[model samples]
Target: QQQVKQSPQSLIVQKGGIPIINCAYENTAFDYFPWYQQFPGKGPALLIAIRPDVSEKKEGRFTISFNKSAKQFSLHIMDSQPGDSATYFCAASNSGYSTLTFGKGTMLLVSP
Candidate 1:
């Protein structure tokens, strides 16, 4: 597993808006970058991810923008909604391991 770190601990955004969260990793060997969305009283599930070779990746209202050169990446939540209010975690890991190193955590509050 790689040591990944994220910031802002929490975020507040308006409904139908976008909220951006940043993360950085120290290991250059890490090849997998994944973002996870977690609701209250639940475990985090995969949201989006990008490999080191890719500059950006998106799925639905979730997007993962990666900067391999900078060993950094971020998650962008588009059209944020009250239902989207939850904790987001940016994670990284190398091959051969199922374990992920997550950041402290970010709680996103989408106000209706």
Candidate 2:
């Protein structure tokens, strides 16, 4: 099975500090990169994503940095808040394929 490895099992940051989560994969066929955020009682939700054609993508306080050649990507939350505390996951898949490989989640705590 394809795998995506994530770093820093957990993280703690100040209210406004940026929390970055990294993920690396080995599959060159994987072209879609997405980040998901999950809260206590809710299922994971798509936060942001980027394609291999782009180097970076930003949406509001969330950003995704992609390195196509390295087959890696990362998610960054800028000006994090207590409400942002949750588990973040990175995933990769080929658009034409039905399989999606996800990395182990990173639990983030944003201090108030």
Candidate 3:
């Protein structure tokens, strides 16, 4: 199974602070990258993502920064709020089959 190493198993931030979660993978065949945000008692929802062709991508308050050379990527939640507290996951998959390998997960707590 492909593995994505994610840092900072957990994090805490004050309101309005940006919480960044980083992930690294060794596989180069992986082409599609995406981040998922899961709230308590709910399924994960796609946050933001970037392809190898793009250095970065942003959707609303969420941002994804990608580095093809390093085979790494990160997720940043801008202006984090208490309501934003949840578990974030980073995933990668090649175009073929769309099988995704996700990071263990990161628990984020945003304090008001």
Candidate 4:
């Protein structure tokens, strides 16, 4: 079973706009939720993360909203710029677990 489900296979936004990506997970054992951003020809890097204990987390222009009871999470990009265009992924993992399952991925395009 796919542990994570992400919505809006892709997105487009103008400069200064906000782009949102959503995700849902099926496994309650998932204790950690993280979002990754990847640019062309580069490896994906951790953008921000959240735990079941926190409802939300923010770092710079990226924010992660999590709902433990609903087993859902979403990422929002504030003041999106063309430079922010990239592929974003949502992932879930349990503490001490070696495996991290990721959502399909969302392609974000920020038009200048």
Candidate 5:
């Protein structure tokens, strides 16, 4: 199992609304869960991550909810804003090389 899949190719959120994206994987061997945020024409930067040992992880307006048993995970964006409109990617990897297997990507558009 070495694949992580994400859905909702794109999303739209109001300035103060919350946007949620879903992801699922088949690999139980994966230990690192990382969500990356990317602006137009830029590389994605690590937003937040959680290990399999943790059930959930949160940072600033970004939160990652994980379910080890189901091999599923999700990203929640709180207080979504125009500046937050960007491409978000979900990735997973085992404890070895930091080579991340990334999702297709989800484009989030936060409007005023």
Candidate 6:
């Protein structure tokens, strides 16, 4: 059903800047929300994630904000660097399901 939708097909920012990527979902059945980062020619890797129980989560310079009621979430990359430039994807999965439905993807460029 393409439950997850992400905005900003592309983004550009300078080093040490913060890039915010937003996403919305339609399925209340989704219990897990994850954001992934992928470099060119590489597979996507989990960057950060949040569950409905938490309003937000943080790992290093990456953070995730989740709203259970609104079925929405977003990712923030703090102090972004050129190495952080990549394609980001937002995804959702049901509680009992292992498969994830992913958003189209947001390409981010961090300029040096």
Error of 3 at 61 (Å): 0.9
Tens-digit per-residue lDDT, 1-112, candidate 1: 4577898898998999999999999988788988888988888998888888879898998888898888889998888889999999988888977777889899999999
Q: What would the TM-scores of all predictions be?
A: 0.93, 0.96, 0.96, 0.96, 0.94, 0.96
The CA lDDT at 22 in model 1 is 96
Off by over 4 Å in 6: none
* lDDT (Cα, 0-100) at 68 in candidate 2: 84
lDDT against true structure, model 1: 0.88
Better of 2 and 6 by TM-score: 2
lDDT against the true structure, each candidate: 0.88, 0.93, 0.92, 0.93, 0.91, 0.94
User: Which of the predicted structures, 2 or 5, would earn the higher TM-score when compared with the native?
Assistant: 2
Give the Å shift of residue 93 in candidate 3. Answer: 0.3
Q: Which regions in candidate 1 have their CA more than 4 angstroms from the true location?
A: 96-98
Candidate 5 TM-score, C-alpha based:
0.94
Relative to the true structure, candidate 1 reaches a TM of 0.93
RMSD of each: 1.5, 0.8, 0.9, 1.0, 1.2, 0.9
Question: What TM-score would candidate 6 get against the native?
Answer: 0.96
Kindly list the per-residue Cα lDDT of model 2 for residues 1-112, writing each as its tens digit: 7889998899999999999999999989999998999999999999998889999999999999998888889998999999999999999999789887899999999999
C-alpha lDDT (0 to 100) for residue 100 of candidate 1: 78
The better-scoring model by lDDT among 2 and 6 is 6
Q: Write the per-residue lDDT of candidate 6 for residues 30-110, one digit (tens) a residue.
A: 988999999999999999889899999999999999988888999999999999999999999997878999999999999
What's the lDDT of the predicted structure labeled candidate 6? 0.94
Query: Model 3 misses residue 25 by how many Å?
Result: 0.6
Candidate 3 lDDT tens digits, 16-44: 99999999998899999999989989999
